[model samples]
Target chain A: MAINLKIENKAVVEKIAKLEEHLHLQALKGFFAEVADMTMFTLRFFKEALKPRYEFKELIKQAYLIGYKSFPLIAITGLIMGLVLTIQSRPTLAEFGAESWLPAMVAVSIVREIGPVITALIFAGKVGSGIGAELASMKVTEQIDAMEVSGINPFKYLVVTRIAAATFMLPVLVIASDAISMYGAYIGVNLKGDVTFHLFFLEVFDKLSFSDVFPALIKTVFFGFAVGLIGCFKGYNADKGTEGVGKSANAAVVYGSLMVFVIDMIAVQVTSLFS
Target chain B: MKKTTGNKVKLGIFVSASVILLITGIYFIGQRQQLFNNTFTISGIFKDINGLEVGNNVRFAGINVGVVEDIQQVTDSTVKVDMVIRDETRKFMKKNAKAIIGSDGLMGNQIVTIIPGPAGKAQVVDNDIIATAKTVSMDEILTKIKVTADNAAIITTDLAAVIDNIHAGKGTIGKLLMDSSMAGTVNDAMVNIKQAAGGLNQNMTAASHNFLLRGYFKKKEKKAQDKADEEKKASEKDKK
Candidate 1:
């Protein structure tokens, strides 16, 4: 009886170890698979983005939805960001008797770093979640498959237009955001110190150069592309259920925001290298 | 469908506004760099640029009219700075214009200050090498200040010594300023002079009253009264 019990116990331990190994292998496999899938998706996006048969109407529609719809939110966030940044930065600058440096300082801060990063995060949260959930629902209801069966080229029509719209519109939005943020900064400046609109703008522009503007503007395009691509990828491959839609939406925001910071880091490095 | 159409119109407006803003911003920045307008390149060779870099503003008469486009070291003692100034400003920039490296503010970037020369001189043309003045560097000014301060310190020390000497009644000035006995002697001399002057006045009055000088004294008094009456009449006329 002892020998029989020992054999069973040893077999159970082996089985448990085997199961753990299998789970680890599966996780590792899933990670690489996802990476490979994303790479393929990105490659396909490039292919479709340049194809001859352009989806002009769809592009316009997506632009309307993505760019116009999101402007108010972006503008509000930008205003608050500039206002808060100026108010918070006042005491430190006032200590140095450099209160006049407020407009230029805030302009540099917003144009170079804060504006792009914050706007991209907001874009990720709203647009990324929207894209992810929409695609995921279409996936769960078999709409994507139906489109594929009907020879609709669903990826080109849906993913391409959204991605292109994001890529095109984000820079425009960032420019608008920067302008609005400057206005907010002006208000913030006048809250404590009086600055004419012309003088404030002059101060802002005096500090800004091509280096500050171009690199940041270029990065926003990449940021938008990354957010849209990840959102679309996650949603398109989402598991067929209500839970999958929720998961896709969550992952879209998470990964999109994460990539924005990551891209920002890389952009800063590149900019520093050139500068 | 109607909602989509309205959204499209809104998007168009937003996009158009954004594009306009972006273009305006770029134009302003480009204008600052002398990029959009027709510009002429002029070079200036300086002993030192004083940290002035390419893309730094070049100010003419305290107004930014151009930018430092290129900075190159030609020799150990000479640095060549190329400036791109607006063509519109060319008419005003004479051939004798000078360039000097200056700071934007107390703690701001180094900028090139273009000093306009005599108005009668020929205008500066494209690729013209303008004159450059050696700027008095901050270190040089600090050195001068240090020398002045050192001299001031020495002078103050000498002044303190002289003051001490005056307090001790060592020199002539010291005796005059600090010697109590000398002050008393001077006071007695002043008193004697005052008494002598009073006695001299009494003697002169007595002498003038003599018959031989009485006419002269009376004539002088009459002349003085006439002058006073003329002045009073002139003053009354002026006041009226």
Candidate 2:
């Protein structure tokens, strides 16, 4: 009986090992499958987007909802970002007796990196989740299905408009955000010491160049596209039921934010190459 | 329909504002680069640029009048810098003006500072090759400082040794300051000089009282009295 029990125990351990291996294999398969699906989805968007019967009205509406409605939050965050960064950086620069470099340094930091990345992340959180949840709920309620049955091109009307709006609007929002941030930085500079508005702007423009502004502006378009694409992809491919809506929204934010950093890293590398 | 049109108008306004801001920013940056302004080009040859790159500001008499447009190595030992100066400031920049590679601040980008020459010289024409002046770089300044510091260190070391010798009563100054025996010797010499002076005074008095020297002394006194009377008469004449 003791011999039998030992054999059974060995069998059980072997079974568990096999199960673990299978689970790992399943996870690997899932990852690759998701990658393939996402690629196909992206290709489909490009195909449908370039076709005739452009969704101009829907595109404008999406731009209004996504870009204009999101401005106040972006503006407030931008102001705080610029102010806090300047305030925190002042002591260190002051230690070096380089407090006068505050405007130029802050301008470069905001225009080159901070302004685009922060704005993209905020856009991802607000608009990415909104797109994801809205589409996901529509999918769950079979509204998307009804639209398809009604002979309407739901993907063209729904996804193309959003992706296009996000692509174009983000650059504009970033420009506005950068401007506000500079103003905030000016305020921060004058908080402890006196720097005239004219001098502050002069210092800012003095350090800035086409290389700094153009690359930053160009990258925002990509950042916007990524956020919108990820959100729409998540929502459109959501699973059945109300729970899918929440999951889609959550995943949209996680993946959208991740893509922003990824794209930023690539953009920096590319910019450095040219510069 | 009305609500949709209103939304479109808001979107249009937002986009327009953003585009305007972007254009304004671009204009300012471009203006700084002398892109929009009427500009004239000038070149200078220098031994070393000291990290002056293209697009660095060119200042004429403390004012940013232009930008460095191009930098090329003419030879191994010389660099050619091209500057795009505003056409408006061309009159102020003379043909004899000298361009020196300077810096914005202690820790700032290198710039080309144009020093105006004698006032009567003609204005600098476009494509004029201006004279370049060699300015002291930070490395050169640091090297001089290092030499000075080394000399200072050596001097201080010698001073410390001299002080040590004074403390030990070795040299003349050291002995004068630190040796008690030398102080005593100096004190004794001073006393001897004082006694000799007193003896000399007595001898002088004795000589003046002698018959042979009395006439001489009397004559000297009379002469002194006559001189005093003459001075008194001159003063009375002056007062009258």
Candidate 3:
């Protein structure tokens, strides 16, 4: 009896190990499969984007929904970011007797990095999830299929328009956010100290250059494209009905936000190479 | 339809405002760089730039007048810097004006400061090479500070030794201040000196009263009296 029990225990352990190996292999396969699908999706996007019958009306609508609607949140966050950064940075700079450098330092920080990145994250949370859930629900309800059956190109009408609007509108939003953040920084500087508006702006412009502005603006275009593409890809391919919609939205936000940082890292590396 | 139109109008306005803001920002930065202005180029040769890069401000009379446009290594030891200054500033900048690389603050970017030349010199023309003075770099200042700090450390060490010696009553000042026995001896000497001085005074009185010294004392008294009388006569004449 003792010998039989030992053999059974060994067999069970072997089975468990095999199961674990199988699960890891499945995960690896799924990751590569997803990467392949995403590549195809991106290629399709470029192809459709460059093709003739452009969806101007839909693009305009998406821009309004994505860019204009996202402004209030972006603006509020921008103001807080600027104010908090200045307030927090003041103590350290003051220790070095460099409080006068507040405006120029804050301006470079916001224009070069914080303004585009934070705005893009907020945009991903709002628009990425919204696009993901909307298309996911449409997919589950067979609306995409119905449109296709009725001789309409749903992918061109839905996906390309959104991606294009996102690519173009993000830079504009970032510019507005940067301006508002500068005002916030000015207010912050005057909270504990006094600097005239003229001098404040002069210091800000003194430190800024074409290199700081142009590369930051260009990267937002990529950040927007990533967010929109990820959201659309997740939603358009969703399955399993109502459950799929929730999963798609959650994954969209997660992946979109992730892609923003990844793209940012690449952009910084590329910019540094040129600089 | 109405809602769509309204949304479009709002979007248009927002886009326009954002674009305007961007343009305004660009304009300000450009203006600081002497871009979109009537400008002229000038160059200065310096022994070392001390990390002054292109696009650093060129300040004239404490106001930003231009930007550093280019920097080239002219020799192993000298660098030539090109500046784009506004044309309007030409009258103020003279041929003998000197450019010095300075910092914006204790911790700020390097700037080229143009010190105006003496009046009556010719105005600087475009592409003119101006003289440059070697401004002190932070490393040099820090090196000087380190030397001072080292001297201070040595002085402090010596001072501490001197204080220790005084505490141990090793030197004259130390003995004067810290030795109780010496202090008692000094007190006794002071008393003896006082007694000696009193005896000298009495002896001098006695000596003045002696016959031979009496004549001398009497003569001194008479001379002092005559001097006083002459002074009184002089005052009377002046008053009259």
Q: Best-fitting candidate, measured by lDDT? A: 2
Q: In lDDT terms, how accurate is model 1?
A: 0.93
lDDT of 1 by residue, B169-219 (tens): 999999998889999999999999999999999999998989999999999
What would the per-residue lDDT of candidate 2 be over residues A1-275, giving only the tens digit for each residue? 99999999999999999999999999999999999999998999999999999989999999999999999999999999899889999999999999999999999999999999999999999999999999999999999999999998989999989989999999999999999999999999999999999999999999999999999999999999999999999999999999999999999999999999999999999999999
Candidate whose TM-score is highest: 2
Tens digit of lDDT per residue, candidate 2, span B40-136? 9999999999999999999998999999999999899989999999999998889999999998888889999999999999999989999999998
Model 3, span B1-240: residue lDDT tens: 999999999999999999999999999888878888999999999998999999998999998899999999999988999999999999999999999999988778899999998999999999999998988888999999999999999999999999999999999999999999999999999999999999999999999989988999999999999999999999999999
Error of 3 at A135 (Å): 1.5
Off by over 4 Å in 3: A1-4, A94-97, A190-196, B1-6, B152-240
TM-score of each: 0.77, 0.88, 0.87
The DockQ-derived docking category for candidate 1 is medium
Select the stronger candidate by TM-score from 2 and 3: 2
Candidate 1 reaches a DockQ of: 0.49
Local accuracy of candidate 1 as per-residue lDDT tens digits, A192-232 = 99899999998888778888889999999999999999999
